[model samples]
Target: MTEGSLPRLELWCELQCPDCRTALDDVRALRERYGDALPIVLRHFPLEKHKHAYAAAEAAEEAFVQGRGWPFVEAVLARVTELERRGPELLVEVAGELGLDAEEVELALIDGRHTLAVDADQAEGKAIGVSGTPTYVVAGQRLDGGKSQQGLRERIVALLEG
Candidate 1:
């Protein structure tokens, strides 16, 4: 099948949101079930409430540029509390642990090169009516998984199949 024929899931997420971390379970399941057939794209939507969220999003962009997008995302999401505590230091630490250049990660954060991309994602997310983290967009439908992910996977499956 051509890439355009595949179903895509855009996950509007905030790196510092614990709810986004929980939603990762659904992302993992989708990956395991559909693999390359499903395109699970991560969209940055840093909420104003989280002081470190914007920075984290930029750091994740750097990680993506360094070629470890999802892994870096998972690692940062796994430690939302520490991200809150340590701020940008936590980002550099995680990058180093993931074998990315820690100094380069720091420079990326400092230079703010990924700012526009992250900002664009946030703007597109808002344009799509995504007001919270953990929102899923699939098959032209918006699924709010911010509070509850109940039946979301099934809904996406139905859309993909139908």
Candidate 2:
């Protein structure tokens, strides 16, 4: 997509890391502050080292097919710590909590139905030069660091002002 068609802010993140969750929180705060003026796209870049990373990405995409992409993303980030301690089952539980059909989620996970979607996300992220979790692209500028809510808001405001 052209820069004009791109979101004011786009987030390339992985759900398997606690740091990503924190960064996502900052993104959420920026969304609240800027509303539609700031658009954020969540892209999955599952780290190969994280045992359940790819599986989690697949799960989120499955939820997307069910029209619950954002909720699934929020649930995963909210339960990042629990997911590390517990397991993938907790992700399914979160999906259930978010009103997704548990059976469909289970089937999707078992069959790897959304594997391609996750793979596509990974490929796109790599093409965009995302080398790690929580990479933020704001108005065509890449910020490769963890950002706080206020910090993100400031950056977004600056972009808009410019």
Candidate 3:
């Protein structure tokens, strides 16, 4: 469970979310800025309003199985427009571009293979009063904000220094 010298930050976010999409750079930058000292754990928290969120969550899990979770997420975030228009099908297209099996992502999405994990994340978040996307949990502190790179960096620095 020991990640490294720094702390683990759990990102409770949904794919195709504008807030989450806006934060993509910040999350990427945080990784580059901290390396292994700070690791981000992506947690599914698909809001009910977005119909594609759950399927996207499953696709992300499938991507993780293929060792391409980060790329898959980035791809989805990059095309929020397509996701809003096409729903789960967007995952297939993105996976294909990444050389991951498009059918595999589709099958996972259809059969609900990763629903349990996604559901568990939702339950955990709900229990902790997570009412929105892009919630960040660091050092047992829940920061429900836009999770901007600057904000995230400030929190991490404060945690590391304190």
Best by TM-score: 1
lDDT of each: 0.91, 0.77, 0.85
Error of 2 at 71 (Å): 2.5
List candidate 2 segments past 4 Å from native. 1-6, 147-150
Which rank order by lDDT, best down to worst? 1, 3, 2
Candidate 2 lDDT (Cα, whole model)? 0.77
**Colliding pairs, model 2:** none
> Mind giving the per-residue lDDT tens digits that candidate 1 earns over 1-116?
45446668899999999999888999999889888978889999999999999999999998999999899999999999999999999999999999998888899889999999
lDDT of 2 by residue, 41-116 (tens): 7788899878777878888887888899877887888888787776679878988998988788888889988888
RMSD to true structure for each model, in Å = 1.6, 3.0, 2.1
List model 3 lDDT by residue over 17-52, tens digit each. 888876667677778888777778999999889989
Alpha-carbon shift of residue 39 in model 1 (angstroms)? 1.1
lDDT of 3: 0.85
Question: Best by lDDT, which number?
Answer: 1
- For candidate 3, the TM-score is 0.91
